[model samples]
Target: MFSCYYCNFCKNRKTTGPFTQIPNPKSVLILPKKKKKNRAAHQYHLHLSSVAAGRQPSPLRRPLSPASSVIGAHHRCVPVKLLLPPSPAFTTVVAFSAPAFSRRGPTSFQISALKPEEEAASVAKAQKLRALQTQFFSFHHNKIYTKEAVELSAKLLEINPESYTPWNYRKLAVEHYLSQPDCNPDSIKSVLDDELRVVENALRQNFKSYGAWHHRKWVISKGHSSIDNELRLLDKFQKADSRNFHAWNYRRFVAESMKRSEQDELKYTEDMIYKNFSNYSAWHNRSVLLSALFEKKAEGFLSKEKVLPEEYEFIHQAIFTDPDDQSGWFYHLWLLDQTVTTDSPLLASSWPAHGYDVLLVEERCYNVTVECGFNKNEDLLWKPLSASNSQTARVWVAHLKIPSSDLHSTVEVSVGHSKGIISTRGFEYSHPSMFSFKVHVQPMERDFSQVSVAESISLREENFMIYGTQSEESIINSFNQLSIKNGHESTASNWRSEALAKEIECFRELKIGKLTLARLLMACDVMSYPFANKLVHSEEVLELYSDLMKLDPTHYQYYKDEHSMVLLQKVTSSKESLLQHCFQYKDSVSSAICGPICLRLNNLSLSRMGAFEKLLWVQMLDLSDNELQSIEGLEAMQLISCLSLRNNKLRSLTALEPLRKLKLLRVLDISYNEIGDHSIDTTRYLCSSPLSHSVGSESNKDETVTSDVALIDNWEAFYIFKDFNLNQLDIVGNTIADEKFKSVLVKIVPKLKQLDGKLLG
Candidate 1:
């Protein structure tokens, strides 16, 4: 039964707590009205059997098990203030709905979450060593739990009840501990006593450390305790800050604990309602309570046990009376769902096996799974779930629709193995490689939450087939169409001799900007090395550090560019320099200039780059025809991300990287390259991906010396991967994808999400 008392702010008024109504006048009518005479029949052994259509209770009573002993379940999340007690972490009470698929059968989710060991010393030591982070991550990945941890923690707190650290540590440590799996047989009784004592200690200790008190209440409320103490830990933290949310939250926790054991929950419920009915947090707590009651009542209905059919009706009446009260709704749902499903965690590698309830804790994420049990050969569909108390549930339906095509099959999976099925007929192309850096080389890959996680395998590029530019190819065939269109037949020879001149002009202008190549590089983006190496003579590309430096005056032994100072250290041979540079400021250049740098930087090594890259690999290269047309795949390469085809007779824009994702390509001076407007216009592939930022690599150098950051000489339009510029789109080296500039035909352009030149043309 549930009820909602009146509130002025019912609409804007967020409510809490689970308030179920007790049975009243509406209930008795369902019974035989031998009325006054039958009342005499209720007198003896027929007590509970009265509802069974007449059965007698066995006089023998059984003792309750220590672990399964019920304090009863609350269907809704209690208000933060009541259930958790107000604390800094108890920000506000908010209701969330769980995904509908959270039901499952007998199989518990196999999780590798660890149970942490206890020790006042270890708690402090672990925090200091950052072992908790490491250990948590380790267990999270492996899905293993430890029983020693649960026993050790539960035991340590009993010895020193007032120690808040171990108590809290124990709380975090036991998150994944299932009752039977983690419980220690030898210490079960002592552990229960210790938990109660901790709560008692928390109440005794000025009764105000909200963190300590709230934690204790949660521990005791799990139903392992018979004692419930509610006290005000007066100004526990000495009012260094009076509005401490943590302390205030704890006060709320103690209030909810009072309801742990109640023969008549209404009296306590009324007291709580009157205590601070206006306190929304408390109201939220009430909602969870009501929800739990609803679930219990539902269990009775399912079992043919002692149940009040009319009483179930009363729960509905309360829900209608106060539509916004969470407690009532939660309880009503609980009674409805108990037989339907068990709360199960998701099969992802990131989330915990426990913590599936959102309102159950202050968390950022949750995982849920759902399963449908059926007779053999029946299709899995059509199940009922009108009732349940879940705030954060994610359901994974075990049974699913058959594939529309005869391409693949679905099989049950669990931990210790992964989804490895692949078919030639059905495959998704966009999924990233499932390589992991972990020691195991499992044949299957994890596709769930593990994408873009911290566990992917690290692969470096291994081989190359770099080729260089040959002399400018025949002018007539390359420039035929463009020459006729622009009336530039007279200037055809003129443009062929001018590409290097433009490169020289751009370099000389940077000098006029009062910055050398070093200063410019310090401010370079992904183009740092490629732009600088372009300035170096090509013959010196293979020169060793000492040998090349002795022969070239233009070459320095070593100098910092716009990367990290650590990068410099990594490039060097001296270990002492590496260590010394670590302590310097990130603001200044550290090393003196020295180097005979590689000048023969070429393109053969580049075709095989990875999804991610550092600027060190950039170099000048020629793309003649290692199967070349457009450089579309090189979109992310700002300097190398660009390509030059002065000699190749390319015909279409298909060879270019989608321009939308490249912000670093500034020099599209394919002046002497072969191309014509007849090919296509430049709007094929575009995107909104984040572009690389211009990092001052010189500043990245050890701060022992100072260097200024300067970049582009005469370019005003810089491309960050996010912003797309059409004017910078150059199809000079190749024929446009279309013969008639089809991109301009559309009257109003739709936002370009994706454009394949072949399709657009």
Candidate 2:
């Protein structure tokens, strides 16, 4: 038997006997006395044996009486069988007072029995929140501009700061408050300050909150906060997280608003970089500020001559400290690009090498109007020799109506502001009645007389020394002796070229930044020197790209593209290649066709087509059997008519979008490609299945079922070929080359006379 204190309603005050076990017990009812607080009343019952009812009761061993109003007092244990009511809503807290489980005080356990009242309270709370949202939205929708509405918005926004609508409503409310007749600057400031406080609280919860940040900007724009305070706040935010781009952008906005000098901002960025070199945002900001300073030539800032070297040194230190960091490397490349200057597009050469009726300008030009002495008009219409109807082309052709009077005179041709004179005396009149003449405009001759023999020898010797070639020294000396005999002048050495050579050597010795070294070599060779000079480091650049492909296999394709670009540049830059292969090629009849220039570049394994500006003259190109996956650069071949992309890795027809401008394209060979089979027949069959029964039943009726067929005709291939008037197309050996595709191809290209090498009857 457990000994414990009984309830106050017990009959005996003192202990009498040991607790006795009853065989069967009757139920004893107990009720809680009403409290002055008017709490919910509850009735409890206890069961006791019939034998215990007749026994003398002990204080510690007595069963709870039926009229017991109170449970055991504090620190008491009552051993009684609890019987709950049948009502589902009955709820109570059952507390157990017992001896200490350890050295602690008496262990009390509570069973939290939930009540109807607590559940009701929870439901009321949710209802209140919903009502608050409804009221806030009602005010927003109705455009309510009252003090109460603003307070209500604040209440909602405090719970969810990211809610943009509430922030907007607050802005509207502030505007309404300012528009009041009695609204003074002090009052306006007070309202805005409170709004700023709300935004600040939201920022404290989530520093990157976009709505809070935007609201802060709006508040500052309204002349509520001082620039110093805003900057200090931004400083705090940036100090917490240096890479916060939003904070940086806002800081720039603040600086712009105040018209602060970029020089000060430059110092600030330097400080940020010093604190953390890995901060790309700081580096980017520094680049912008420095570029602006150079452009403006701002006083007290580093001059253009001094700034580049200093920045280079700064970035060099950064990269050397951390080789794997990309920030410093990117900035360094930018600085290098800035140092290199690109030459403007000039008239490279012209075709018809003598006097001719048809004139071809061998450089990309737009809005070409030519003024010639042969033509009566001041400007004759010259069209781009482009089959794609492009605005620009390397070869611009014009058929001049040359008058008989000007045939013997020197014909002056003017393209834009630049003018060139062609002697009509050299023209041979093949057709005297038609007035056909051939005029060739050759490039101006370079003056080699000014070149110094001694400087040439010294430069060659320096180059040879860098290469460490003893055999080439004798050859160079012989060349120098020839130059001396030919009577050339003396000049100073090219210090810039020597400096680049030294830098290249230094980078080679360091053996780091292979990509950087490769780019530097390219800039030194291609950009640093004039077009007439030979590229000294082209071979080394190509070798570096090859090494990079192996070293960084993840960017292998990128390196391969770069290698292709360099190779194409070398080929295009050659005088012989440009004149002989590109321009002077003739048809089988040994006569120059006035049509598009044809270039046979097949089997070159070219993944990318570089030097687009140089090859814009080409109209008929054979690019078959290579690693070409996409025809992106082919659009630049605006004059192309016949294009063969057979046995390539073209996977999608969408890659043909670049060729959409090639309106003159007729003969196309896309055979053996990987284009997917998005057959129109399949789509038609799927869409027509539901209408088949209807057609069969309504065979006698006049209802047409061509809607599904019409829908199926809008495939991608149809769209790509809709504007095309192709006469010959070969799509054989591809997955898309089914019989249905062949039938659709005939419909898509209505002018087609041949498909897949077979005549489309």
Candidate 3:
């Protein structure tokens, strides 16, 4: 018997193995290819069989079906293995071939099998689709936007609506068609609506698909929009998710384009807020609508004298209903903010009185100069009214005393700024009016109003110091009368008493381990009530603030600072006592805070002079914008690091010599001062002497006894702090000439890495 076995593919025999070569004894048979895709399976079979042999195999003689082969030829070789019978007399021959089957070959159009016939059909369809996609993309890349190109992109978009590239190509295709000068508007509108539908359908499939939304916006923006319908669509989107800011933004755009009535928009926002007061977007939108609605009204809630009490009620209701809702509180704040304003100038009485009178003026004015008729021209002392007030407003007071016999003296008043000065046209001797000592006090706002009111009262008390009990009683009576007129009974007899009561109440709450909103509000009201202009210095307030520090550690410094401010206000004697008190409580207060508050203390009364030596532990000191003539007291603070003396009255670098002992000092800001650096002796320590060793130290107390040398007359004389390790030095806003400063200062301060806020090379 003779038997033959064949494979779809064959390999050449490189070496003889196992089977013997056979002579021609049997006929050969080849099977036909089944179908287009199945031909690849046939080719794979042939290739496998050829590899099993050791010789180079011949290629398949038959052609492949169209779908499997790109070049219309079979690339695989088929090999046949034959087994010959031992004798021809026992003749029986059989041939066996491997099973015929098909595989979807690895190509761009490849599809996994489902059913045999289905997979073949699917693969053929995918191949045609891929070819079509390639042609379409090629046309798009080449900038072809013809009708056919548009159709192609439409089909691509149908397959992948979220694909940005296809959407962009589609937009380009439509735009190209519309760009033709002869294009009719109706035709364009029809095309645009169709494009809109495409995006709408895409959105229906995937609502949050960015490309679909963007394309819809683009289509509408090209003058094809029905804004009313667009708004309705956006409303639906927002209904799905009320907090969707994007949908809200789109709705706003449509509403604006359609010129939606402000009232209607406001009502819409109100509806949204009513649904969810915590929705920040709705609240924010409501605020915008309210502003727009109120802009034209003279007595609008956010405008002039006629404040919107109803708006206030609404906001208050929202906040009270949900205390945790920041949106309500934020809107409430916006409602309370001041609008555009007019002018009110301040009037200052004699220094002994130190009283301020705010005068209503038609024109805005800042600086006021008062001149009393005398033998020669004299300028009175004048400054800004307070730290928080505008610089344009000045308080002018003089120390001049008028003789009893010559009580009627003419005075000239002028108010102006950098532009020049404008004086009253005529000088006159004026008599005091019935309302001379009375000042109108407005209702205190929330939060810091207490501090402001108290500070004001403190100023008034200081001004009336010389008048004794009668003047004090008169001022109290004036405040009482004003409060009665305003229809509110005076909360306390006076500013001090009211402040003390607030302090007590704040402490009582702390003792119970509670700081409720009601209590906090009551504290604010109590502090701000009765129109007091005196500083509260209650120990209980300080203690309450200390307790608050623990409860709200994030604002610990703020509480400690308020505590320090309260204590300083109580310091009736020397300013050094304030510094001492601050130092005593230094464990609770931060170092940087003391300086500005200390400056405020000095400005409050201007009655302190001494070494700040007792404040030994303070590290950072900001003495900016103060009336300091010298830095003589800083020697005691050896641990000081940052010192800001900007906008001061120091005239020479000699005042800075005390800083030499402060070796830890690094940042020194003396900008905007009148200090000069003309050659002066600068002391440099050859060795660091212990802080204990004063100038009086008796180590062989004779002339030229120590290694310390004074560099005299050289520009290096300004280098006293060379050993102090000063890295940052600010001298900005000074009149120091470039020639003098460059030749002198930079050479001396070689260790400085920063000068006047600029980094040095």
For lDDT, the strongest prediction is: 2
The CA lDDT of each predicted structure is 0.27, 0.52, 0.43
lDDT of 3 by residue, 1-761 (tens): 00001101011111111111211111100113233332122111123211111111211111111011112122244443334333321222222222221111111212243798887998887787687689887997899987777777777666556567879888888878888898898889889988887876776665555577778878878886565678777777778867554466566677777878777888888888888876656766776666556564423344433434456557656655654444564454344331111112212111111122222111223434443333243654543321122333222223444344543444333322222222221212122212222222232222111112112111111221122344334333332322112222332234334333443454354332222222233243333322332333355555666566574443333334334434433452233334332211112122222121112232321111222312333444546565554454345344456666767655555446566655566667777766554332111211122222332332233533134322234322343444446677777766553445644555566666666656667
Predicted structure 2: clash tally: 13
lDDT of 1 by residue, 1-761 (tens): 00001101001111111110111111111122332322121111111101110011111111111111112111222222112222221112212221111011011222243346545666776464454445544543554446555444434434433345556665655454435576664455455566556555545543334345567657656665544333433234313323233433554455455643322443444454454322222333334444445446443333312232332344445444543333343343333222121122111111111111001101111222122121231333311110011222111112233333423332221221222211111211111111111111122222111112122211111212211121011111111111111111221122222322332344345322111222222222112121121223211212222232242212121211111121321222122221221111111111331111111112222222211111212222234322223342233222222233434333333223233333333223232334454333221212111121222211232322112111131011122121332222233333432423324211112222222212221
The reply for model 3, stretches above 4 Å from the true place, is 1-175, 198-218, 298-307, 338-761
Best by TM-score: 2
lDDT of 3 at 607: 14
lDDT of 2: 0.52
Poorest 10 consecutive residues of model 1 by lDDT?
Answer: 1-10
- Root-mean-square deviation of Cα positions for candidate 2 versus the true structure, in angstroms: 30.6
lDDT of 3 at 753: 65
- Clash counts per candidate, in order, are 89, 13, 24
Which of the predicted structures, 1 or 2, would earn the higher lDDT when compared with the native? 2
Best of the two (2, 3) by lDDT: 2
